[model samples]
Target chain A: MDTTQLLKGVLDVAVLAVIQEEDGYGYDIVRRLRAAGLKEVGDASVYGTLRRLYTAGALSTYVVPSDGGPHRKYYGINTEGRTMLAEQRASWTRFANTVSLLLTEQHQPTATIRTIGDKS
Target chain B: MSTTTSPTLAIHDFAAAVRAALSDLPSEDVEELTDGLEADLTEQAEDLDAQSFDPGDAVGYADELRAAAGLPVRGKPRLPSAWTANKLRTWASAQRSNLTRKARSTAIGSRTLDFFISLRPFWWVLRGWAVYKVIAALVIGNSIASTLPSSGTEWVLLLLFVTVSVQWGRGRWLPWSWLPPFRTLVSVCSIIALPLLLVLATAWSSSADQYVEDYVPQGLLLDGNQVSNVFAYDSDGQPLTGVQLFDQDGKPLTTVGDPNATPWVTTYAADGTEVILVPSSDVPGRTGWNVFPLNTVDSVDYYSQPSGEPDLSTTTPAVPPFTQVRPLTQQTPSPTAPPTPVPSSAPPVAPEPSATPTPNSGGDK
Candidate 1:
């Protein structure tokens, strides 16, 4: 399975989790996500996801003016977003655990292998 | 490397190119992108030797940096939303196709409509004889005032003409139901009262001229009294005794001396009837000649010298016999008839006059 497709399913939850750690700018958030081993995440795709999460009320934005360069827009998760992330994380963990158990279950073998001329 | 172009200039040029490429983006986004690109270029410039800088490589690097920064790619630009991208594409295509043509045609159509709307009523006014008459009266009045020597009156008449013309034009152009009550009143007054007032003023001025001709002294003359003619003589009559001239205000204008005084021929009939012959003198500040009977002189003539030709050619025409004055012995009947008797059922009081009367006063008393 493509991890990119899998990450697409969990991108909003991942973004919310990152912001839950600390509020960060778009580029900073992308760097943090890369540090966390999601290296295949495209910059444009993360930015798009960030913008969508913001518009969906899962994240809030504030401008921090910087003297050395352009002002940076920082995003952070709110209470409703935290609650949703927790619930999605819990459901994903439970489903993954159940699938793992089913895959790892041992099966008992039945009866015999036939030989060419069995016994007379 | 020998060129004087600054590194900042190159950076700014790059930024302008970026802006041009990203013209469809929002203003805030464009500003952010330009700022970020400039910072990146400055860093790149600081790291490399200025003399070894290549503009093509710099542009290609800038494009790569922009792509890394999550900006939309040039050829296959991405929008924030799919719906917005489609809309922008459609609008840009339409703009590229016929924007200037549509703008030019719209401008021409609007201007033509405005021109016709502005001019239609004035053309109608010119075409209609009655409307033209009122406008002509206003124009004549205004022109007369404007040509006069006084600047104050010229300004006043100019203001009046503009105001009346605008009001009248509005009334003529708009329907009655569309007009406010005050505007309707102004339109009516401009059409009717203003012209009538102008005619009356002119008539009053002429009447004043007649008064001056009858009463004012003209020159030293040897003939009949000037005062008696105030009631009867025509200023243009024959046997001119003295010439009377008047100003525009109808006041008798005096000359510097008796030399500049208007001269006339005088004659008398045998029965003490005097006839004055006043010739026309086109002197500056003088208007028309007048004759008057000698007795009607309200004031004495100070100069008493014979002026001009005393053509006493007994060419004096015969005077008609004067009617003798007689005191009345009996009361004369009133010129108006007695009031007719009202019927017993009718009221005794007379009927009131109508709203407006004929000049003969048949209806309105």
Candidate 2:
């Protein structure tokens, strides 16, 4: 049930798509991702992916200070992140189509009889 | 605490655990990674099917954070050496704090030290290094210089000192075979007693400077050999500036024919002109000479400097008599007492050759 490996490749696009709609802090993003049916998503993985995208200049971030709890760090998708999301989505579809066709392709097996008379 | 603990404390503990796991990362990155984790944890904890969160799960969360952040994983299989060292360090710190509770919680002394140390957390950041300087200055003294193995050896010792001291402040004393036992004890004891020792060193350095006017070229000068603080004092203890020395035994000590080049040749220069080398630079740990000189006599195998090369080899016989010590010179006092002024020590460098590393109250492994 752990889709961590599968999720890793597509996470960058998934995160950018979520934040592109609206800015969200860490826990909010996790809740949104879970709601989108990415059930096995780990909390830190999303946080890390968000940080990674922000670091890569694909996303932008800002902090909103708080008194007691730690200040909130909000991430929002920018031009680069949006471009990356589009590119990844296109490639993912192409790859998925190729794999899907192979899965659905039908094949028939054929057999030949051996000629023992020539051997004798 | 059990996993069934309340969500509030669990969130705090979770944050602490995550912080601890991410400790080796850059401070900026750790801050960014941990930002809002507690607030998020609090919200997540409440919505859990069970109202409790196990703090043990924090590491797994940290791993996820690291991975998604494009940081390296903890790896599937841990290297045994690193694992053991990590365990030892953790154990040492916990024990250190537990053991030093009394020292840390005491009245005025601990409070003031803590206040200053807290104000400059950079001091704590380099607590690893400050701990080294304090130990080198106060406890180990000149032994480090002379006993040095090489740069590599020093690097290893430095690494070891940093490793041990970190936990030591917290209260852990690791008794590993590779770390010589006495050094371990000294290091642990030193970290535990550092604040008190620094207070004592500062106080002692000041008073000793007042009582000991080593600049007078009298009071059996210490460490003059390493740097020039030499002044030729007359039979009456009156300094004869720039006067060349004549040993009681009349033996030339250094190749330079000047004691200024090798001032540490003798504690007391005899009545005849003894070259007194006065150092122009400041000493490392503190400024100026103090009367409470370390009895470095045994540790240093003093050589007659005439050859320039230290005569450590057995082939070079008998330590120069009055060759240094003009020990015979202390017996005779100058007829007239010249008024002496105490000057603060300004030794620029402190270096000792480690001919034989002294085993401090332990057998060196």
Interface root-mean-square deviation for each candidate? Answer: 6.4, 1.2
Number of clashes recorded per candidate:
17, 43
Instruction: Give each candidate's fraction of reference contacts reproduced.
Output: 0.04, 0.93
- All models, DockQ values? 0.04, 0.54
lDDT for each residue of candidate 1 in A37-110, tens digit (9 for 90 to 100): 99876544465566656644568888889797776778899865786688779988897899777666535322
Write the residue-wise lDDT of candidate 1 on B1-365 in tens digits. 22247877876776666567666556765554454445545544655586454344434543543454345656675555775655665555645433443333577866776686789566433323223334445564433211122456544554565545555556544456535444544555556654554565577678778898898464443243322122122222222334464558986533211333544333443334334533223333222233222211111131343543444322222221111112223354652542222112322222111112233322122
**TM-score (0 to 1) of chain B, per candidate?**
0.20, 0.20
RMSD of 2: 23.9
Q: Give the per-residue Cα lDDT of candidate 2 at B199.
A: 63
Model 1 stretches astray by more than 4 angstroms: A98-120, B1-365
Clashes (candidate 2): 43
